[model samples]
Target: MSDRPMTTTPPRPPAGGGLFGRGPFAGAGMLVEKSMSFWPSTRRLMRRLAPERARITVVLVLALIGVVLSVIGPRLLGWATDMIFDGVIGKQLPSGITKEQAVAAARAAGDDSFADMLSRMDVVPGRGVDFGALGTLVVWAVVLYVATSVFAWLQGYILNDVVQRTVYRLRSDVEDKLNRLPLRFFDGQPRGELLSRVTNDIDNVSQTLQQTMSQLLTSLLTVIGVLAMMFVISPLLALIALVTIPLSMVVTKQVAKRSQKLFVAQWTHTGTLNAHIEEAFTGHELVKVFGRRPEVEQAFQDRNEELFKASFGAQFISGIIMPTMTFIGNLNYVAIAVVGSIRVATGTMSLGDVQAFVQYSQQFTQPLTRVASMANLLQSGVASAERVFELLDAEEQEPDPADPVPPASRRGRVEFEHVSFRYEPEQPLIEDLSLVAEPGHTVAIVGPTGAGKTTLVNLILRFYELDSGRITLDGVDVTAMRREDLRSHIGMVLQDTWLFGGTIRENIAYGNPRATEEEILAAAQATFVDRFVRTLPDGYDTVIDEEGGNVSAGEKQLLTIARAFLSDPSLLILDEATSSVDTRTEVLVQHAMAALRSDRTSFVIAHRLSTIRDADLILVMDAGRIVEHGTHDELLAAQGAYHRLYAAQFSGALVTDDDEVSGEEEVAGVRG
Candidate 1:
């Protein structure tokens, strides 16, 4: 392997601004700007993931039909009320009312109320009365109600379809992003936060779309249609009814403005609590081992209290809107009634007109009140949208070149030349590092904690880009190589072994899917994992719990070794491979590593000096620079940093043995 560092180029700006706004907020128009974020993620969902035609068609058809029926239904109810008044109360008609009453009823049922009103005209008609008109009107009213129900149900069905399907796709997309994201992303973000994104955030968005969004539309349409009808009846009365509209709108705006901020806080606090709970539960073993139960509980209680306070503040303030709207709506209703009564009494307005105006006033206020409540719900949805967009907008691992060209051939010669990197730019983790591992050689990196040992492996994998210099595989720049292709040819055994929830055989075969049972068994046996597998009732088919929790740490490491062996990778990295295992297990792991690295270029970051004593080359890193390099014998002869560490650990071991032997010998002599 060569010691040339892998160079990194700056990230390219995206082709277009993504769904989440990256632009500077101009002012109050930021809501509109941020709303635009909804479009990109939506468009991606529509164009890339699912067919727009299917979901869009369903939603539009349902919304159109529902809006039409929703708008027309209230007017029909007003008409029906007018008919009852004219036919039953106008002439003091009894149970077996006159032809006028029947005719009035028919016209009330139809689109036009002319038949119902005209039936009362003196000198009814030289021609016989057309009762068919009244019958048609009654039938029309029933049909409209039925149509309304069908459309409403259809709207609900379609909304549910969109919510469920959209969430499923979205979750799958998020999981894939998590899988592909660089290891550093996890370092910066808590697992719980990402989990909340997949679960809580998406669920909020889904619930909003499925439920509240349609209500908002329906309420808006109702408000509009009612106002239009009122204006038609009497513009002056319509003007009176709208007096409260502006006031109510002002009040709602104030409430929304305040509640929006609280809702955001509420959601943020919820994520914090969720993360804390998850962490607490996942580390319960450590908590018990260290007897930190009280402290952990107190921390959790503090987070819970924060969530409660935020939720109470948000919901309490948001809850005021509907009641306040209802108050304003009732006030509007009284004003319209008082005003319409005078017009009717003065003979300036007909009784029917006044009655219709009263009904229209209710229509106007009811939807307005509903819309006020929906505003609160929408605030919650927007919060979730903001979070989802935030994730989507997160700086992605910079892309490789569009037309990446793979190396003509690779002999697994790796190099790091003047490579420097840092998790944070100001606090450099690895600086001016240079190293090399020739093909078919085993190289070891040993260092104390914070010595940038594992960081070196990260550089080789290009999991992070270097601040300066270049890394190459067989002289081809790794930065120019396709990430998937680069990773496919490399195998890694992390310090913390993670086995997906699956069978042992499946986990081992993860790196190489086409491995036969025979190959898998051979790899397992080579790693000494087959000894434990044979004891299990299901043998290789035994299920592994998440992260291989069912297995001991040593066994998990052994399984990881088996997996690496099965991969047959061109380049292999074992980070702290035997650190958590016993001496017996370490020997087995070492034997496995030696067998696997026979002809492959391997880089090992080991805390145990004995494991790497036989390595072809050893690198001692400190503060991101190699201070020593050579075989174990060469480094020991040099009496450098590597020699000091080795000598210290070896001396400590010898002293410990001597003390134990002395105690035993003394006891033996006394007994004799």
Candidate 2:
């Protein structure tokens, strides 16, 4: 098997906005730069890896050993060279030593049978290399290299385990956090930004951990080990070796300071570009229908140009660090050479000692150059980690009640009492509102734009917390119950349908994992989905492509209804559920919905007055207050907000607060 290590990446989301920040799933803008604290993000990330502390420690130990062994090899070579020089002087040999002389010398030294010594000795000088010492040093050097390789492999094996585990846990945490985050968090935030955080940001951290971070540890160990060895060889020369560090640091620090902002801007621009691409691709159909292709392209081009500038700036600035440090390292090498030559001439230092010091100096400067190279990875990783950590650390849903109230039968008697809320602290949307939805009652909430219709159900689902009041299901406060339990008692179908990429059977079964075939087929038949499913070549087994692209919008809506039917929820929320179907399909679906609504409390948020005409109670909302509350006939007789809304819609005129009916119908709204 190949020696490549395993890694984890998120599953690809389905097309047409299956993930975040695309088309129908769009969220807030993410083009602006974010100010992130690096050390805090780094600390939080390290803490997340605490569970793998033992493995990390082992990897670190191996790195230290490898670095020490690597440093020792050069010093050993220098020692062996010095030994060869000493032998040359002692023998007073010719400039070219032959095999005959090497053999004769070896025999005379006390071993008459030791042959092949000539091959091991260096013949550049009159006396060849000290065969014994040179051969021993060469053998030991190879051994150290082999041992270093093994340790490096082991380090990689263990470190990869730690990094992947950390990534796995972090990804799981992000997923859980997304679920726990309040709806307002999503409503006000850009989905693309969140998508970038979960994907790009995490990948950056993973790449750094897998590759550059290990290199960083080794480089650090090398610097320390080489420094100590240099001092051991010659304190004066070692001090000369130290000259490169401050110069390198000053250069690296200056470049890094400018580069940090550039890197942050680079990722921010990347997210922005991705956001636009996602939006454009998902909404390409709308763009064409509205003749907005040029506008969309211009917007995309603007974001792309911004991204290019950021990327180029980040890379150009960081790219200078390597060559700059390399030049400074060369200067240090020259200083060491000059100082050591004088020391050697004065007989204060041996040729071998000077040679070893030179080697150690190179060893020292090599890491400094590497430190500069890895700085880019370090900055990029920290920037990305900060984003990932932000999502992980975001405020979660209000904590579930301790010892939550026991599960009780759901009568679906929902009540909103004196509920006051604002997505923003300064802008209140709902205030002092009180409403009781009786069991088996159909309550239709109609409102002008920004009237907080959907926000009401969001509160009921415990997706957001009420600032000052209680929402209850059968007298049990929803907030007092577990979110999962509260959600289990409710099912929702919105105007926008989201169908996963799967077979028809699987998509329907998503609503009821343990549902039987008979029940599934029954639900399908009840929602009139079986009428179309039976006509398909694969029937229930037909696979829906990503975003259910294979199916018509009306068919997708029917499937959702069928899914809801399969769940048999105690309470149902419909936000214009039939708005996607044709007139004939709508009539049939309405018949199915009428059946599904019986004996179950249902809330319908609608704009079309005709759809909710039969609603048992209609609450006409204006601003944040209910201006009219009664049945269709009653409200029509009252000539109130509901009456005005119905009059405009019934006459195919645009609605206004003044209730004037002009012939022009330019203002866009949901049927009304």
Candidate 3:
């Protein structure tokens, strides 16, 4: 509401920030110090995937089939190994001797332990190696392996499709949420922070889902299948492998708890850094003019350092899981090997069963390691999801009426009856203010800094809702009309010109897409845009950059004016429209405005006294109230607030009853 131009400032972190004391290593220290809503956010993220449950169910079934086939292959290979071992042993024995005879012979030769091992071996002493049976086992193992791979591939392919579609819906919802949010919601938010949520955070979520979804599913199912096989082979070895599980879990839990906080900090710092960069680049010219590049660079460095520390700490802590898991897995392997070998020597278990158990133990431990390693990615993804959910859950504007009331006619008559408003609840900016702009009248509003000049026009456009009373356009309450329908009949020309990246003709056509080419040319000529366009090589086809740097400030203002001229609205709001134009251009703009204002209600907010001298009615505002309202000449004759403002402009000094200028009064005079 201040008279100063409304500009967005970059968000900054608080000084002496974070849980740790400010130091070079403070960012690192704070990484694991802050806590987040990890479980709640993760649950909500899971809920976001609910719509893809059908595809997920299909993937789960495939993964289960693949894991079952995979586990069966190792067992089949174990069988083949047993057949080869038996054949080799039988070939070494006498050709017609039975297995019992060999054991008895060994026992008689004073080799009881050897006899015991020979009794456990399933060997036909009279037979050589059976190549046909061995080959059949090997062939079956290969087939199972191939089938397992095919199932895994199909599941992975389907999972990827599900993830992509989920992310697509999320992006679309975010875009729609932005449109539904009220203008006030954006007032306190930084543009870059919002952009980071929509672009960067959402992208991180997509990548996390893509990388972890199928892998996590497959790993978990493999662990189950492998564990069941190990038990079937040898319960003792299975129990040994199970011991390592608790140790692996303890390590994973500790690391994940620490890394979750770090990942949250990392994403938070990313958003802050993005906000600073956006603000810096947006106002780069101002920074250079003020010689504040070093300051901006220092701020960027501080945020970048914070992000770096958080990221490093997260990756480093989470990286601990794999090596620690590998160590525990090795211990399990040693225990299983020693026990299985002893059991084999004792003639209580076959060598092939022990071999299969060893393979199953490795398979079980490998999946555990994969799951542990994925903890960091899961945490990071949930952090980003929480941020996105916050945006999606923001309070939206009140909905439009179910059945909107259209205006009785398109005659531009606006009324503000007992309207009250405030940016903050405790500090009122406008209170019980009333005004009327009759049809086809030019109302000039002149006010000092912080005198609610901009807020007044903003209220007319329904950019904000009044705390009390109502605004009407053509005898119908504005609130009863849909916002789009109400704004369609109004045109605005702001001091800060805005043009998208497009040709000059396209920018003008943005005002009225249905406007004919001849009408567009007429509007441009009326606003003197064609005069400059003719000078350029491309004329109306000249392209404007994203920042519109190709055109001068005056030319930009002229183009905006031409756009407003093309709209031909019933009501026009011009807020310092001529502030950026040169004196010569101002004359042309003033003439164009005069023609544009014909038979239309117009509100002009200006600080320059000369610009509004010819206005039909001049309203002088001070401290949220209108102190004087009348014709310019009548106000000058009265020699009140408007007269003093006019006198200050022409005489360059404010004269008061006390014949002395107070600082506050002097500032008001200068601003007026």
Candidate 4:
């Protein structure tokens, strides 16, 4: 890190910087709504979904059977019609009626023309009407219908399995991608927005695959089957019905091309809203203390309204597909009826055939509506896939070299040789500066907020690659080592302590998962966490809830310290490690730190004036440079920046919690 003036220009922003100005979603509400074709990109998802090709192949074949049965049912019903006609003309009734019964029934209804027609036909035995053939046709129709229903159910089952496995793979890929991405990538993103992609976007993709995308293949097959059956019934009628396809396609293409833009805008604004909610709720206490509730409510209302406009526009436009297709379908039905009646009158077609042809026309056009709706769904799914792909394809940190040096016999020695770094390329924050801490030495860093204290530690740990010079561990440059290997030798306890949802023992053992019960207890005792664990009823078995909120902030800090102790790293970095503790706990923590410092080299970033008086070395920093370095008494006798800083604290102008110097005090957590 450079020790240059801290007021230099800033560094390059994060990956998503193009989306905003200063903070996340500064002007994210405005959208560029443009319809782009989705097929080319969503095709990858299609391939991804059917990774088990044979499974999807069987699924498609079963779907085809369902479609074929759907088309065949009406035709079979037409066959039953022909059988009934044969029964009427032959003067022998089907099994439900005898010729004598039919005549009497017609006479009772006072239908003389029907009674006469029944009387004129040649009466035969039950064989005259071919009731046996009709029975067989009826049975076949029932079997076909049942099989169709079974195929539908079976297809759904297999599709669900395929979809779940594919989404499982997608989610796993994204999780691994997060680990490989550079820290700067996260610095530029909102946690909630990223989380939204993992959940909401992936869910959208899953729903589309389960409910619609998979249907594309089957829908196409149904189209082919229906058209073929229509032609077989009557080619003239089939020609008339075919007009619905192109007409509906033109309408669908026009509406979906425009509505696609609105869907994209909808999802983008949703992410922005999520980002706002995440940040706002995380700091709700600050919001209430400052009476900013009205502003927060207004922001929420504005975001919601933006989302509403996009949602309403997209849904309303795509919604036109159903009604328009229905109108066209009804028109085709009328044309088929008119044309078929003329053919029947001319004796060119059978009455039953015309009825089957009408059914075929309706069946053929219905899936047009399905396809149109499917198009809209595909557009939405593609939008979500794009967001997911963006994260997966993002630039990742460089991998370890082909050959990496492993740490030999561990040493606590660390050295910064003429190091320089800047958060912003144009603005140099730290200049050529050097420091060394030998094995078992204690180095205390004290500076105003943004005076490069945290940056120094970040560079030493190789969080951000240095712009110039090198930091080494025991004479080996840290960059030459694999990052995981380099980090393994050091442990950190930050002011913002993070504890996962697990038992206290599990959390403490996180640093060394294989630690035995005895080892864990020893580490807990070393860090003074055992004192608090004893107070809790469950002790080490006590489960910590979300963010460890069940415990006090100070207790959470001690648990983290215990975690570091279990790791037993040769080097340690503590940033305000004792800030949240009470005076009594602080005494115990200091005793623990003193004991741990005997074997490990420790770097301490301190805000309290009283915490580091006994340090082996004190580095007093101003702006970004260390102006003085010596023992406590030597710095005081020299009467430099450290002396003045110490005098301010001693004179009661600076307190442990809040310090005031030159009648002004800077708040912490600021970055240079």
List lDDT for all candidates, in order: 0.71, 0.79, 0.83, 0.79
Best by TM-score: 3
Model 4, 504-586: lDDT tens per residue?
Answer: 99999998899999999999998888988999999899999966779998999999999998888999999988999888988
lDDT of 2 by residue, 539-645 (tens): 99999987788899999999998898788888999987888888898888778888888879999999877788788999877666676798988887676577667
List per-candidate RMSD values in Å: 9.1, 10.2, 5.5, 6.6
- Ordering by TM-score: 3, 4, 2, 1
- Whole-model alpha-carbon lDDT for candidate 1: 0.71
- The alpha-carbon lDDT assigned to residue 181 of candidate 3 equals 91
Prediction 4 TM-score vs. true: 0.87
Q: In terms of lDDT, which candidate is strongest?
A: 3
TM-score of 3: 0.90
Clashes of each: 21, 2, 1, 8
Off by over 4 Å in 2: 1-34, 93-133, 344-348, 651-672
Work out the TM-score per prediction: 0.82, 0.86, 0.90, 0.87
